[model samples]
Every structure is written in structure tokens, then in C-alpha cells.
Target: MSDTTQPPFSVLFVDDEEISRNHFARAIRADYRVHVAQGADEAIDVLARHGAEIAVLVTDFRMPGRDGDDLLRQVAHEYPQIVRILVTAYADKDMLLQTVNTGDVFRILEKPLRADKVREALQLAIARYAERETRQQRLLAMSETLGFLAHELNTPLAAISLFARSVENDVAADYDPERQKDIGAAARAMLNNAQFCLTLLSSFWATVHKSGGQQSVAEAGGREVRATRLIASLLDTYPFAGAQRDWIEVDVQGDFVVRTMPNCVALVLSSLLSNALRALADVDAPSLRLEVVDGSEPEIRMRDNGGGIAPEIRARLLQDPVTTHAGNGGHGMGMIFCNRIMQSFGGRLGIESTPGEGTTVTMSFPGPRNRL
Candidate 1:
């Protein structure tokens, strides 16, 4: 018995024979709202008009002019969410296997169609559609929540940064020179960390708003930025604790322009910088170098002389969220996130390390023509 409390979800049926279309509709119209087409062309036209309303497509494999396989391929590309089912009296095993492997058809119904079997397939297809919709909604909700938290955090971070700057500037001349220097350094560190946090939050907020909490790469556009200037900015703003800033060197082979999202680049640099700093914590006379190599494929390499990563851990660093500093609240997602961002920019992130020697992280970006 059809539940008539609400409008039934729609199904599109395509068959060349008039009797087959009529019989199929009559058998299932009580449970589903049916739309029938005489051939593949008519089916495409019907889809153009009611694609959003239709949840499933049931097309006979044999039809005049554009057969079911061709129609299924077109529909699969155009309307991926719609579940497709192929109905055929003469089922070609090779063709069936190919369509199934390519994910064009959810099910293949052998004809002399059983009403119970058809109904069962429709039920399962609808369930699968519902599951995809639910998963999409959850991801959107998570993105929105993260954006909201980032937005809310911006205020306090900005306030802290402003206060730190003020303290650094308003220090009294009556204090001893050495004492004043220590106080100023502390204030500067606080200010730098606060500013870095603000930068990350702002970028995240913009990304979420631009994509409307959806998954996309090209929605956030890129712009041309000078490589030397970007490296200088990162070095100036990065929160280097006590004498750590003195341990670093910058070497630019040539100046070039890179087209990418600067905020995203900054976020990646922050993650790499944090990791490098932690690794250098116990090393003597630590050295970190930022070298920009300009060519057809532009790159910024960060080389640090620190306790290098083990081979086993380095193997899965980018592929999985695997971290060595789990005891320090590391969830191991930093490298994974960085890798994803680099890929979205049509770029790549690579790492090389030798234990007891050092680690060098490379960020390679596409040339001007390949920018995303």
C-alpha cells in the first residue's frame, strides 16, 4: 500500500515500447511518482526539466537511437546523485561489468521484470541517496562551526596583540637597559604569536565564507605575490623564542612572483616553523635556513639542523596524520592539513630528513600558468 501522506519521491523510466512503459508505471506508481519516456532523447529532455525532483533512473538497455549505455553514461556525468538502474532482456556480461565498475549503474535488472525486485532496488537506492545527503550536511555543519569559532577568537587575539604592542612602546626609560631589553623581547614575542593566530583565524573565516561551508579548491582565488617579500614577512612575524631568531638565515637565489593564496601559504609556513622549532629545542647552536629557489617550478625550502625524523615516521607524515610529539597534545593532523592546502593550490609539499642530522621541508608551487 502506498503512503499518500506526502508526495512520493520521483522515478524516471525510459523504454521504447509503449506497453512496457505503461505496465511499469502502473505497477509502481502507487509507491513512487513515475515519469516515463519513449527513448533516450526523451529521457534526457525529461531529466532537464525535472532532474532535481527525480531520485532514480530506470532505463531499458535496448532502445532506438542512443542506447541505454550511452544515456546512462551521460546521466552519470550530469546527475551523479541520481541512482541509475539498467533494465534489459538480453544482458551483455562485459557491458554490465564495465558500467558497474564505472559507477554508472547502481543495479542491473534482468527483464521479465519482477515487481517485488524492482521495488526492493528502488528502496535501497533511496536509502543510499539519503545517506549521502546526511553525510554532506554533517560536513557543512562542521565547517560552519569551525568558522564561527575562528571568527569569535579574532576579537580577543586582536586585543592581546594591541596591548602587547602598547606595552612594548610605553616602557619607561628609568628601568635598567638590560631589564628593559628583556621586557621588550617578552612583549614582542607575545605580539608576534597573537598576530600569527589572528592571521590564521582570518584566513579560515574567509575560506569558509567564500565556499559557503562546502568543499572546493578554486573558489578561493590566488594572486601574484613577490617571493622575497613573502619570505621576509614570515621571518619578521613568526614568534621566535629567545635568541632563536638569531639562529636562522635567509638566502634567495632569484626574486620571482608566485600566484597563490598568501594566507594559505602562511598557514603552511606556520606549521612547518612550529615543527622545526620543536625539533631544535635540545640541539646545540641550532641553524634554520629559508632559501627561495626561482625557476620554472618555484620553491621555498626550509632546512633545519635539529634532531631529524626517523625513516619510519617520515614515510607516513604527509599521507596520514602521524605525529612523533603525541605526548605534547599533537593530534598529527598538521602535516596532513598542510599537504591538502598545498595540493589545492596546484602545488606540492615534500620532506627529507636523516636522524641526528636535520630535516629539510620543500614547498613547490606551480608556475604562473598553472595557478589555481
Candidate 2:
């Protein structure tokens, strides 16, 4: 756990004591590019002046005016990208607990910090920072890919969609009942296929465009959203609502509400619900159960009482894309989309299936600040 291998990163060592600050600074002089700050005010000044270069904030837990915890809090608020570590001589019970509870401090190094220990902590901090930065970069790259894909889809969709409307209009005005029925059927089929394609294209487009734009920046707020309401709204237009909801009467209308982005949630549910419908296409007594239970978080389960996925397919169902249904051109994209959406929302997608019994999918997210 040496910092010698890492690319040079700027680190801020904050402490009221000049001797301690110099000692720690000298310890890492061989590796990291260090900047010493005597107090919180000086640290703030240094950060304001050189925020972009600072990668790690190593501060003592006890300091004048603003203690280590307070300094970390400010850093957390001002520069969340800069990793904060509490290195203090006064490792009292209160300080230790507060540092842990704030959730801002990356690691707590006790007094009499050795050069090796300091080096190791800085390495860990740098690695963690790099990992998060990588995720952000990958996310950005995915956004770019989606934007390029959307541009590609626009050309073909424009031609197909416009032509489908023209064909439908012609059939309506000229054909007789029998002749019109055949023509209408073909037109409708083509229109549906084209619409599906457009939907996918637009979805990708929206996802990418939003990612690229500033609108998708993580916002801090809360909204009331009912799972049942989302379902009810889609029941009329959702393709599988009739087949799946008919047997099982959806009774939970407004039982639970969550604070989340409706569009992101809809994307998750639509993908999952659509897949469930497809999976139960030929099964007897096809039924779906959606229940929102009160707990540490909003746990919503969508389970279908249909023939479960085969053992071979069950293992790879969510992890890998497998062609189970051929008629609808199932590429397993729907499930993948659902899983990714869940993960993005700090939730998880889980599945339970018995070869001959049924399949159940569960989604869980943190409850609204407090338990409902």
C-alpha cells in the first residue's frame, strides 16, 4: 500500500500544530504533492485558491474555530470530489462517533501516525476517488454512445413512420369492409412495429440527451409517487395489462407513495412489467402480484404465478441476456434496462424462480427519509 505508484495528486494536510503538520507533510514528501494548512480558515483559503488540484484533504480531528469534523463537513459540502480523512491526536469517543456518523470522513488515522500508515491511507483515498471518477467517466461515455445511436435511428424512423401513416390513410379512404380490413391489419401491424422501434430510439435518445445535458444533474428533493397510480395510468395503454391484470384484481390503488423521479421509475417498471407479461404469455392462470410493504425501505415485489423460467435460464436471467421468447425478438434488453435503472436509483433487482412453479421479481429502495 505505497503511494509511489500512483500518479501525482495534490493533498491538503490541515492541523493547528505547525510541528505535526510539517511532520506529516515530510512523510509524504517523497510521493504526493502536499499543501499544509494551519487551520480551517487557511484550509478554506487554500481550497478556494486551488480546489481543482486538491485530490485529498487530510485534516486533524481537533482544531481551533472549526474542528476536524467541521472542516470535513465543509469539504463534503464544497468539494465532494476531494476525499476527506480525519487524522487527529484527540481521538476521543465523541470525535470518533461524529466522524463516522457524518459519513464524510474516508478514514480516521490516530495520533503518532507513521509514514507507512499515512501513505497507505492516502493510497486508499486516492484509489476510492479514482474509482468514483471512473464511474462518472463511464457514465458520460455511455451518454455519448446513446446520443450517437439516437442520431442513427432518426434517419430510418423518419421514413418508416411517415410512410406508415400514409398507407393507413389510403386504406381508410378507398377500401371496402373486407378489403379495408386486410389492408388495415397489415398497416396496423407495420405501424406497431415502427412505433416500437421509435419508442426504443426515443428512449435511448432521451436517456443520452438527458445525460449529456445539465438537467440530469442529481437533484435534492422529494415527491409523492404512488406505485398503484403508475400502474393504473398504464393499464389502459400498457400492452400486457389486459392479459396479466385480468386474473388478479389490482386493489392497491394508493397504498404506498415514494419520493423519486417518476420518469426513471417508470422506465424501470415498464421494462420489468413488460418482461413479466412476455414470460407468462402461454402459461396457465397467469397472475401478477404487486405489493408495497412498509419497512426500512419501500420494498415492491412484482411476481407472476406463471410457469417459472427453466433452471438453466433462471441462473442467467438477469445476469446475462438469453433468447427465451422468439416471437417478440427478445434480446433481454428489457431486463438489462430494468436492472440498470434499479441500480442507478440506489436500489436492487432480485429474482426468484422455480423451474415448474413461478417467477418473482423484487425491487427495493430507501424509504422516504422516515419509515412509512
Candidate 3:
């Protein structure tokens, strides 16, 4: 007898033949929560009602009106979290392989399906769904934790900045000319660093609030602004010490406009500037240039004459949060965050580097009319 207790997740099985649907459901109903449908249309109806509860979708390939492939495509777009499995006969194996290659199907079961094989496929699909859910939860938790930390640091950082400015003013009034210059420089450095920290905290808080911890950066509200003007504002507000400010050059081929959340863009540019400075810490005559290119697809490029990245490290930088400066407290999420923001705006971020030569990071945005 099949077990009567409800399982953690449910499965939806669709087939044109009533016997096939019933047999498939009966074979695994005891171990799983099963819903049966006669055709693609009925299966879609079931999904509309119980999509959240359903973890796996098992459908036969040869239905009368709409085939399993068509149903799979629709499900893949609408209910992407559901793991999909296709049931087909041996004659349809070649075509089914193509669907699997396209990532529409997870596992395929042969017709005249054996009870044992059906149970095994359900086990694997359920496991996959559980893993995905767990990963998403972890990411949300991490984001919340970072947001809390940023909130807590804001108060003390603002106090420090206030004290630094006071000290600069006092030094200017009381100290001898030579001594005043030295003390004022130190005080200004402290002020600049504090202000930079404040800027980052503000940007992060805005992002968390706008996204509500779930939505993409594109969904965050924004206004259209010229790329060159934005870059100029960022440079003016950035905390650059000593000769570092002189090392940067801005070139405007022609200004281009894009619609994006300004605070998010500030956060990205600040991170990039920090990384570029760190890379040039030991280099001779280091230079960093910002270029705004005007065309159908606008682009903002940051070129730095620092120690360029190696092939293997550069490949993984955008894909994963892997950092080379792990020893120096680099969590490696800067580029990953930047890439995500660009993608959310229907834009792209690319990096070109030749070791010992230089590295150029290009941000390509949609043309004016396409700006979101």
C-alpha cells in the first residue's frame, strides 16, 4: 500500500492517455503529492492553481493538441522554478535529446514507463528543486546582513567626519604656515575617507530599500542623465589622496545619456576606482583614464595602467565572487555586483586586459531611445 502522509513537495503529471496518467500517478502518489492532467491545456490550468506547491512537472511528448515540448517551453518561462521532465517513447528519443540540450527538459522517461524509473526521476527532480530554494534563501540572508551592517556604521562614520573637519579648521587658524599645511593635509585625508565611507553606506541603503531585497536594479527607479556629467560628479566627490587625483584623466568623445539609478552607478564607479588605485599602488607613473563614447550603443570605459589581471583570474572575476586580494579583506563581490547592475539595465560590462600592459573596463548601455 502507498504511504498516505503528504510529502514536502508536489508533482504534476500530464499525458493524453488516461491510463498512462493514472498509472504514473499511482506509481509515485504514495511517496509524492501528485496531480494528474489529461493534456497540455489542463496541465497549464493545474499550474495556474498550484504552481507554488508543484516542484516537478512530468509530461508526455505526444499529446493531441499541444505537445509536451510546447508545454515545457511555456512552463520554463512562467514557472521557471519547477523542474521539468519529459516522458516519450523510444522513437522520439532523438528529438527529446534536442529539447534536453536546450535546457527545457531535466530528465526523460521512456514510454511503457517502469515504476522504479519513475520514482528515481522524481527523487532527483525534488532534490534539484530543494537545492535551488536553499541557495536563494542563502543569498537573501546575506543581502540582509550586509544592509544591517551598513546601517549600523553610518552614525559613527558621520561623527568622525564632523571631527575631522573641525580639526582642519583649527589647524588653519593656529598653526605656523609650514605646520598648518602638514596638519591640514592629515585632517583632510581623514575627512575624505570618512565622507567616502558615508557615500558607500548611503548608496547601499538606497539599493536595499529600492530593491526591497528582491527586485533587480532595473526595477529600481531612475532618471536619464548624461554619462560624462555623472562621471565628473563622481570624480569630484571621490576621496583621492595626494597625487592620486592628478593621475586620472577624463576624455569625452561625445556625451551619451542613459537611464539608471544614480546611487547604484556611484557605488559601482567608487568600487572600480578603489580597485584601480590598489592595483597601481606599486606601479610606476600609473594612469587611469575615463572615456565616454557616443554612438548608437553608448559606452563608458575606464582604462588603468596598473598591473593587469592574468587570464584565469579575469575569466572568473565577472562569473563568481572570487577575489585575488583575499588576504587584504577583498570579498570579491565588487565586480559581480557591478555586472548584475549593468545586466538589470539591459546593458553589459566587459573587461580587456593584457598582463604588464593595462586593463580597460567598458560599460555598454542601451541607446537613448532604449534607455530604461
Question: lDDT per residue, candidate 2, 1-372, as tens digits?
Answer: 355665468899998888998898788977778899999989999999989888999988777788877788888999989998887665375658867778478888888788889999999999988767656644643553444344334433664566577666766686567766666665655664465455545545554554342233222223345666656654544433234568544535235665433345555665666667776777777777776665666666777877777878767766776646645545554455556655654566888888667788887775666321
Instruction: Estimate candidate 1's alpha-carbon lDDT, on a 0 to 1 scale.
Output: 0.76
Report the Cα RMSD per candidate. 14.8, 12.5, 14.4
Model 1's number of clashes is 0
lDDT for predicted candidate 3 compared with the true structure? 0.77
Q: Tell me how far candidate 2 lies from the true structure as C-alpha RMSD in angstroms.
A: 12.5
Per-residue alpha-carbon lDDT of model 3 for 315-349, expressed as tens digits? 99988878766654566667776776666556778
Q: What are the per-residue Cα lDDT tens digits for candidate 1 across 165-213? A: 6565657545677767767766765666676676566655654565443
Q: State every prediction's TM-score relative to the real structure.
A: 0.51, 0.52, 0.51
- In terms of TM-score, how similar is model 2 to the real structure? 0.52
**Local error of candidate 1 at 190, Å?**
7.3
What are the runs in model 2 whose C-alpha is more than 4 Å off? 1-185, 191-223, 240-248, 251-254, 368-372
- Identify the superior model by TM-score, candidate 1 or candidate 3: 3
